[model samples]
Target chain A: SAVISQKPSRDICQRGTSLTIQCQVDSQVTMMFWYRQQPGQSLTLIATANQGSEATYESGFVIDKFPISRPNLTFSTLTVSNMSPEDSSIYLCSVYSPRQGGYTFGSGTRLTVV
Target chain B: AQSVTQLDSQVPVFEEAPVELRCNYSSSVSVYLFWYVQYPNQGLQLLLKYLSGSTLVESINGFEAEFNKSQTSFHLRKPSVHISDTAEYFCAVDQAGTALIFGKGTTLSVSS
Candidate 1:
């Protein structure tokens, strides 16, 4: 099992600003994923970050808008850029565990853009 | 590609009553099934998963799910629920250790 510590639990930001949410895992992991959960909606994958490679984003998401950084096996960050009210959501980081056949997730960073 | 459908958006049940959260999936190949629970203001926690072998999988907290391959369904059930069981539950699928494809989620509201 991996424990992830995410910083800035909740933040209120102005529109057009950017906020970087960091996720630090206790163990080394091959892949880290970022997700968004809007109010009254299910989680949607934003991107997948692998150490030492460019992040792979899902449909309707782009690196320019939600850039990701995976500096090493145990750490990753997701930046929400050019924020808007529509972008206000809970951003989460998850790491897949093959042995467990599941993913361990961070507590999530709640963002409110005004 | 894979997709999961959690038929019920919300389920309200009285405490100590049986509850079932239905989940169905669509996939062209073999897949793994998982159930996750999310409490208020927290990240999702794994409830249980079906990888291989027996079709029935049980979680520590008395939650169980039956994997019916023919129907492509993995519905979560608890014989009796508690007030603490009130939370959003998600059903997900993955093929060969890939990223999980999640359902829309079912909100289980266990009340008195």
Candidate 2:
């Protein structure tokens, strides 16, 4: 199975600030997804990051609010722009691995906006 | 489109007791089912999945889930649970070449 290393496991930020979460996969994968799990809520897909292309954002999400960068096959980053208290949530990255026969998720970044 | 439903928000049980976490899903196309466990302040770990073949799938641990197509259900069960089994369980569904859709997780609390 592929291992994903996500940084900034948690953070406390002030409103109007920005935070960029990163995920580095041990193995190269074609597609990587970003998800946000609000407190006491289910996981919601934010965007899909494909190498060498602009990410495809979900309906409720926008490029200006949540910009994704997929520089290469094994690396991706998601930035929460102009954070607000409502933006506080646990963000996770995932990759579908054929060898593992399922999706592998990162440890997740917990953001708290005040 | 696909969606998952976890009937229980929380399940409390004593150690060594039998437990079941119910899950149901709806999808127009053929889909895959997965059960994931997330410990406190940690990431999600794949518990088990039913991709094809037999309807029953078991994890390395005691947890098992049976895929029922007619009922559109994939409920997880363990004959005997341990205190270590305490965690949030999530049921997710995914169609071929698509992203996964997750259910609102169920938190399992196991005590002595």
Off by over 4 Å in 2: none
Worst 10 residues of 2 chain A by lDDT: A96-105
Give the per-residue lDDT of model 1 (tens digit) for B1-112. Answer: 7999999999999999999999999999999999999998777889999999999999999999999999999999999999999999999998866688889999999999
The docking quality of candidate 1, as DockQ, is: 0.70
TM-score of each: 0.97, 0.96
lDDT of each: 0.93, 0.93
> Which residue pairs does candidate 2 place in steric collision?
none
Point to the candidate with the largest TM-score.
1
Distance (Å) between predicted and true CA of B31, model 2? 0.9
Q: Write one digit per residue (lDDT tens) for candidate 2, span B3-108.
A: 9999999999999999999999999878999999988877788899989999999999989999999999999999999999999999999886368889999999
What is the i-RMS of every prediction?
1.1, 1.2
Model 2 interface Cα RMSD in Å: 1.2
Model 1, A1-114: lDDT tens digits are 888999989999999999999999999999998999998788898988999999999999999999999999999999999999999999999998887767888998999999
